[model samples]
Target chain A: MNKNRLTERKILVTGGGAGIGQECVSKCLSEGATVAVLDRKLDKLEKNLEKDVSINSTVLVEVDISVGEQVCRGVKQAAQELGGLDGVVNSAGIDLVSEFDDMNWDDWSKVLDVNLTGAIHVCQQALPYLRLNRSSSIVNIASGAGLVPIQNRVAYCASKAGLIMASKSLAMDLASSDIRVNAVCPGAVDTDLFRQNIRDESDIEQVKSRYAMNRLGEVSEIADVVIFLLSDEASLITGSALAVDGGRVFH
Target chain B: MAGEFFIEFEQFVMKQRKVALVTGCANGIGRASALSLARSGMDLVLVDIEQEGLDVLRKNVIDLGSRSAVICGDCQDEHILDEVFEFAQRDFGAIDVLVNNLGRSAREHASSFLDSSPDTWSAVLDISLMTTLRVTHRAAPSMKRRGWGRIINMSSDTALIGDEGLADYAAAKSGLLGFTRVLARELGSYGITVNAICPGAIKTRAHDHLKPSILEKIKSTIPMNRVGEPEEVAGLVSFLSGDGASYITGQALAINGGRYML
Candidate 1:
């Protein structure tokens, strides 16, 4: 990967504290983008950074994208700090693990508010700067649950599905502005969320046996996708929901 | 072939010799596709129920001088799939290509859908249609991120032209074509191209099991008047996965030697 590809470009990624979001931040930095990391947990961001350092650097901001005021201020600060904005990656969102019938209004609202509405808020706040840039893009981190129905996470599925459609609509609206919009639907990635799920399962081996490919995916795996969607190499790509789920959804 | 198309594809494939995870590699078409892709220097994650066959494939892919991991398991099992992907990434790095080449049917169940049990139909769909969906869903994210990914799904000519006795198999493969088109539309923007390949009858144990009279009748329908080779179908799979077909998405390219066209 060329360090100059994203050189001098200002990129903002939400939920940058952990998992897929963290990987995106690191990848953007590696591609030479001046990245702004946004997350609710400042400590997690600091701790996550202790892992590996990219040749390209980033500025970390503690703000929740789900909150409108926080989102606006965060975008403004990131834009100011980085000089200007070239792209926004809406990778910050919550994952609730519960069935629809067993869930309450709060669960549904929480999932939608964070996953779907939070993405809208980020885009809404970032659009002004995004529209002004000659080259800009928005990459949303959706899930395979959004594309294919997952068994126990109804709210998560609905929110992700909405995000997919929302990304498409946004792509169409921003196509002329040269700001591409896209979403990545990751299938069971090997993150903390997956580890927790695995711990909860009685027979972990049996659970892993479901996919034809025979395993879960890595966070870096999903991050590599986000980088591509946000890069100039994908100049013609827009209004798409790509899946990164091993072979889980194939059948 | 268009000059620009070939150039673009060659550049794409060489620039990122993306790894591929292929299902149903025990024998038949899946094994052939895997070997062809390996020959092209793409690392492979080969899956199958027959451990012996998979071991042989691993050796062959290694002989091609490309990295390969053999996964012996049933495609219907989700856990096995997760491992296959993990192995692919752990050994070969990111997956840039995915080939869904698994096909199977019970001896008696191969007769007619109306006579087959619900379990038989479900099994057929799981292997043919669902397997395609699952594997592509898994491999696409990184491909999308890398801004270049290729998905070559294997559908059967029977699916397009239809087969009275093999209703379950036909329906499953037909459904796979539909899945391929929709996925092509959905994943086009993230730099991922999705397409399906429909192969005609080839010489394999699975085909050999079919009644001789029916097999002869099938060959007569072919304008080429001969059975197709697994390698021939594999060639198309390789082409589609390579850069030569970058602009070609939402397409179901047929490789049945004029036996069927759609």
Candidate 2:
């Protein structure tokens, strides 16, 4: 809690406006790293965190990650803002709850475009800056649904699963350059989105029962794991998928 | 390497110092893990087959401002393992973490597949997989009582790749991965997290036996074109033992510099 685990590091976090990505921004900044928050809604994040940290420590890059052109420019801007890049958190993703046969191509492809392709785009664009550093890490926010199938989430599952494999393969390809890549899967977390959606008493209980801990995880819990993976403490780790699920996958 | 992975971070605000027992604490990953845990403010119960390395590691732990107790004996010996547990109970009262670093089976003379007899296979299994089974079995009750525990088992990337001349080591490590998962499921309910660390081409003392040409070949095979350091593997262990890794379990975390991906 009192460690500067990522001291002097520069990090770029996608979807930093809310949820797990927002928490990662706060934690990384508190740990002595300057952060570039790439999001479509920077005003919301700025309002929430303006009081806790100096405005100088954070750089805002407004971009919708799904667009490759925006992502390319955003990655370059973020790298320039933070001086250089040491870490990246590909946390921008959307979950589509639709049956496979009922889903439209736009919806399905959008999910893949944002979650899987956008993440790869960010990594690909940031490669040169990342290579400039002595060591760097890329942590993609994959999900438990990625590794395990869930009903009514064909697109979500596929996108995350693809992101997981992409992360592993990227690690394999970039190991020679000392750029570490890994994916973190969060099972069920207590995000603002989940709080708004799972409102019924039965629905809440049903979700909790799925995990070994019989509860949902906090966004801060997932953020904690993400920062740990980004820091030097995990130097030996590469091409690994870390689960921050609170024992949800045990069954 | 394609393998089982595991890790745990501090889930609760620890008010008391945690105690960890590390087997094969004399050198390499074991020695580095003991030191890293010491640096994390955990008291250590260092175990190994020799007193010299344990003595030195104990001093290093003290230098890091932590307490340690060393026990010298082959952990594969049932009596030695018993003594280790009894000593911990008498002195430390509980072990919050266990590092299974010793991988030698009692009869492991020839590590190569064709040269290894049945005895060699069983010996490797007894030490790597069975010893961990016995120790975890012994440690789980205490962990359950406390509502938290961590177990780290050392596997090799060879277990995933089935590298030439290392079939017995691979089989034993593969078996350890399965045990890691089953226990991670069972003990997870009790707040115990189990995981395995698979290291590839580390420049440990054991590697000293490998010819320079062979070592160079191993390095070439790794995409990073280099061998890993003991401290690097220890860094993973240290992170797994922290509160941040609390949710990671039943995994085989490979630190091979991308030599193989599973």
lDDT of 2 by residue, B137-202 (tens): 887799989889998989888778988766677788998888888888777777777888889888
Q: Candidates' DockQ values?
A: 0.01, 0.47
lDDT (Cα atoms) of all candidates against the true structure = 0.76, 0.84
Candidate with maximal lDDT = 2
RMSD of each: 15.6, 6.5
Candidate 2 lDDT score at position A243: 73
Please provide, for model 1 over A1-251, each residue's C-alpha lDDT reduced to its tens digit, 9 standing for 90 to 100: 44355777789999888888887887787777888888898676676666757423667788877778888888899888888888889988887887667788887898898899998888988998897888698999988788778678888889999998898778767766777788877777767666765655554566556443345667877776677667664554566565655444431
Chain B, candidate 2: TM?
A: 0.90
Name the best candidate (by DockQ). Answer: 2
Alpha-carbon runs more than 4 Å astray in model 1: A1-4, A48-56, A200-203, B1-262
- The sequence of per-residue lDDT tens digits that candidate 1 reaches over residues B1-262 is 6999999996676556668888887687788889888887788888899999988889888889887778889877899888988887777677788888886655565666567788888887777788777777778878877777888888877887886777888888888888887777667666676777777778877777778898889878764455777777776677667653444456565555445523
